[model samples]
Target: MTEGVDPRELSDEDLFRELQHLHETRTDTLLHGSDDALERHTSRTQELEEEYLRRYPERDVDPDRLRSGARRRG
Candidate 1:
């Protein structure tokens, strides 16, 4: 539901929180919502992710790891 809010205006903590919420909502929509709902969620998730990456480039993940279910060991 944070459709039109400017991500740049949010504090880092708030941005992270919003990203987490978006991820959760996207997952829920994927499991139980209609096609239209999923589409909307996907778009919104992408927008948030782009902004997040822009602000925190180091947090970007490798596509291969995502597809292969690999976690970066700390």
Candidate 2:
């Protein structure tokens, strides 16, 4: 926690900073042979990002299409 910054209140820049810190911490913990949780989380995150890219080929999608596609069932 940095000063009085609530995570929900943080701007995107602040949130990204926190995310970078978390990534470093997780990487360090993994390298040190910590629990399997970090590995599972990283794998899942990558898988979901890849899947999203695959399902939505457009790099810049229309908002309506994005929302409608997201709402559709698999």
Candidate 3:
């Protein structure tokens, strides 16, 4: 449905919203959708994610989510 919109043209708020929507539907699309549908979802997800990263290159990192953090916790 959102395939018609380009990630580059979206605002920061809209891009994040689209990313959330895509992620929410990802499981169903992967398990049940057709190959064509899955491909489109994957492509759109990547485009939006890349744009988000481009805009927020300095996003805060959560060290507890990293590999080293896991080892420490264990």
Per lDDT, the best of the predicted structures is 3
Model 2 has an lDDT value of 0.56
Best by TM-score: 3
Which stretches of candidate 3 lie above 4 Å from their native place? none
Question: Cα deviation in Å at residue 30, candidate 1?
Answer: 1.0
Count: clashes, candidate 2: 0
Which runs in model 1 stand beyond 4 Å of their true positions? Answer: 60-74
Assess every candidate by TM-score. 0.64, 0.35, 0.92
lDDT of each: 0.77, 0.56, 0.91
Candidate 3 lDDT over 1-74, as tens digits, reads: 55668878998889889999999999999999999999999998999999999999999999999999999999
Rate residue 47 of model 2 by lDDT: 46
